[model samples]
Target: MVIFKPKRRVCKGKEVRFEITELDPFIWLQVNSESHVSYSIDGFIIDSQKKINGIFNKYEYELGTTLDVLFETLTQTFSQEIYACASFASILNTEYRIFIWPKDFPENFNIQDKLIISIKPVIKDKSIDLSSYKLVNMSALESGIKKLRGYSFSNVKSLLSANSNVECFLANNTGNPWPGDLDALIYLKSENKTIALIEFKTHNKNTPISDEYIGKYGKQDWRRFEVLYNLQNQLELAQNHKPKIFYVVWGTKDFDNHKMIKIDIISNNKVESTNYLDRPAFGESSMELFNLLLKLC
Candidate 1:
C-alpha cells in the first residue's frame, strides 16, 4: 500500500491535513484527525478491483451515476451503517479514482463547513497531483438532496423534466416562466403507479410557521402551490396515474428532523395546504425518508 500526505492548510486559522491511501480496489482518502479536534474517519474497503474499474470507466464523467454507484456499493458492503453524507469522486489516474467524504468536520473550521480538494492525475507516472484545496459550505437544501441519492428510487426525475422539449416542468408556460422548479419529481412503482412532487426548504429552528412561509396559492404572487397543482393535473392526465404533491422543510441546524406539508388542489383554481400528519417529524435518515415516501405511495 502506498500512502501520500497532502499539504496542510489553515482552516479558520488552524492547520488541517488529509491523507490519501492507495488500496487495492478503492482509494482511502480521509482527514488527518490529529490536526483537527472532534474529527473521526470511517473506513470501508472495496474488494474487487475489476468491479471498481468497470464502474469507474462506465460512469467516469457522470457525477450523478458515479454517486449513485458509490451509494449502492457502500450500502451493499456495510449493512450496519448509513452513508447519508456529501461525497464526490475524483479520477486519480487512468486506472484509479478516489471517493472522499468530510464526515463531521468542525462547523467553524470552514466557511461552508465543507472541504474541496482538486487533483491532477499523471497517468504515465500513476501519481496524484493536488492542485488546490479549500473549504466551503453546503446548503441545507443541497445536502438534503445529496442524501437522497443514497436511496434507489425508480424512474427518478429532478427539477429538469425527462423530455428535453418540455424544459424544466410540464406546467411551465413559454410566455411566462415558472417561478421555481420542483426539488424532485419521482415515479413510485406501486399498485397505483403514483407520482410525487417534492419541494425542499431550509429554515431556522426559531422561524415560525406562517402563511407567508406556507405560501397560499391563488393569492397574490405565491403561485408555487398553484403551479404544483397544475403540474399534478398535467402529470395525472398524461400518465393516467395518481399525483401526490408535498413539500419538506427542514431546520438548518437540525436537519435530521423535518416537517412534511401536503398540498391538495381543491378545485381548478384553488390550492390548499395540510399537515402530513402520518409522519409529522420525518427524515431521521435518508433511508427513513425513502421508506416514508414508499409508504405514502
Candidate 2:
C-alpha cells in the first residue's frame, strides 16, 4: 500500500490538511480527515483551478440537467484523458471538491466503474475515550448476509423479510435499487439489537436554509426514514427491539462548537421542528448523538 504523508495547504484563507493512500485498486484521498474520495483509475492529475465548465455548459441545455445524463455524456465525450469530478460539503461544512483527469485512460472506461465516496470523522482531541463503541465492518457484514441468503440484500423488501443475527444493517445497493446507505447505524453490543439509525447533512454556515436545499436533502432523509421504519418493523418481529432514527445537519463550526441541528420527522418529509443540539460531535468519544442513542437503546 502507498501512503502519502499528511500535507497542509491554505484554501480560502483557511489551512487544510489531507492525506492520500493507495488501497489496492483504489486511491483513497481524504481531506482534513473528514471528507473522503476513492477512485480506481490511475495517473490522474489534480488541478485546483481547472473546471469542467465547458462540458457542463455544452450538455446542460442539450441533454437536460440530470446527473445520469451528464455522467453518460462525460463518459462519451473524453476518451484518452477522462475527467472524474465531484463536489460536496464535508463533514466540517467546508466545500470539498475533487477534479481529476487521467494522463491516459482506457477507451471503455466509465467514471462510476469503481468509485466510492464517503465521510468519516477523525478527531485529534483526546479529552474523551469511547473504546466500548466499535465501528462495524460493513463489508464483512454484507458478505455474511449474502452468504446466508444466497444472494445480495439489494432491496428494502429483501431486507425487511430477511432473518439474521446482525443487529446493524446498512443499505449497500449502488444502483439505488432501493434507498442508499444511511450515514451511521449504531447497535447495542450486549443485546445484539440495533438502537439508532442516523442521516447527516453538511453545509456552509452562510448557506440559507431554503426550500430547494430542504427538498434535496429532505428527499434523502425521507428515503432513510422509509428504511428505518421498515427495519424497525423487522426488528420488532425478530428481536422485539425498534431502533430510533435521527437526522442531523452540521455547519463549519458546528463540530468544534459542539452544536448541530436535529430535524424531526414530519409527514411528507418537510423540514420542520428543527432544533439545535448542544453536544454534537462526530467520530469522537464525546459524540452527543451517541448519548441520545444510548437513551433510545
Candidate 3:
C-alpha cells in the first residue's frame, strides 16, 4: 500500500480526507475529501515508489534533473543483499528514494518526515500444503532442474547467472530446458547461440562408493574423470561453437592434489576447512549448484 504524508496541511478549504486522482500515465495528485473537509497528511508517507513517482512527477518537478541514492542491505543465505544499481529523484530540493529495508525493521516505523521508503515484494498467502515442500533424495542437478521446472528459460538463465536460487525464477510460458542423464542444459544469451552442457558431481563425506572399487580416490574419482574426459572430447567436436561443456564438482577432498593421485587414501587432517580459494576444479560448497554453472561462463 502507498501512503503520502505532507509536513503540514496543504489544502486551503475545510477538507478532512484526500483521495488520489490520476491525470495521466505520469501525473497524479490528491484532492479534497468528498465531504469537502481539509485533509491532514501528518502521520504517514506513501509506501510505494511507483505511486509516489507518478504523483510527484519527478521529471516535471525536477525539470530534467535526477538524484541517486545508494545503500547496502544485510546479507541473506539464499538471496541477494546488495543493490548495485539504484537511483533517486529530487523532490522539492530534497532527495526522494525508495528501497526495500531489511525485514528486521520495527513494525511501528512510520515515514512521517522521511524521504525514503522501501518497495518490497508483496507477500502472498500460500495455498499449497506444507508437507508438499518436504525434501527428498535428489542430486544437485536434479534439484536445480526441479526448482526451474515452471520458470521461463530466460528467467532461469538470469537467475543462474546471478547465482540466485532457481526457486525464485519467475514463472512463464517460455520453453524450459530439460535435464539430461548427465547434466542440465543452459542456453547462452549471446549472439553465438551456444548451448552449455554441464555435468554436476559431488564428493562429500556422504557420497557412497562400491566395495569392489579399490584405490586412493576409488569410484568417485573414476566417475568424475570419466565425465571430465567425455566433456573434453565434446569440446573438440563442437561445431561453430554450438555446444560447450562444463564440470561443476564440489567436495572436501581435492582431485588434482598429489595425495589423491598417489595411493594415500587416508587424511591426517581431521579438521575440515570451510573456506575455499578461487579454483576451477572445486566449488565453495555443495549448496551452490547454480553458482557453479555461472562459473562456467
What are the lDDT figures for the candidates, one per model? 0.30, 0.31, 0.24
In candidate 2, which residue pairs get closer than 3 Å at backbone N, Cα or C atoms, i.e. clash? none
- Model 3, which residues run further than 4 Å from truth? 1-180, 192-195, 204-216, 223-238, 242-245, 250-296
| Candidate 2 runs further than 4 Å off | 1-179, 205-224, 253-259, 263-275, 279-283
Question: Which scores greater on lDDT, model 1 or model 2?
Answer: 2
In candidate 1, how many Å is residue 108 off?
30
lDDT of 3 by residue, 1-297 (tens): 111111112122123233322111000001111211111110011222311111110000111122222111111210110110011111111222122221211123332323222222211231111111111211322233334333324453322211111111211112332221222333332322223444333333434222112234555544443432333343334423433444333333433431121111111211111123233322122223333333433
Predicted candidate 1 versus true structure: per-residue lDDT over 1-297, tens digit per residue: 011212212323222232221111011111122221110112111222311110110011122334345434533532111111111011111122122323222222342444322122222232223222232333331332223223223333333221111122212222211123234434332222335555544444454333324443335434445655654564465457656665554343333332332233233443444444222332222334444544554
What's the ranking of the predictions by TM-score, best on top? 2, 1, 3
Judged by whole-model lDDT over C-alpha atoms, candidate 3 comes out at 0.24
Best candidate (score: TM-score):
2
Q: Number of clashing pairs, model 2?
A: 0
Worst 10 residues of 1 by lDDT: 51-60
Arrange candidates, best lDDT first: 2, 1, 3
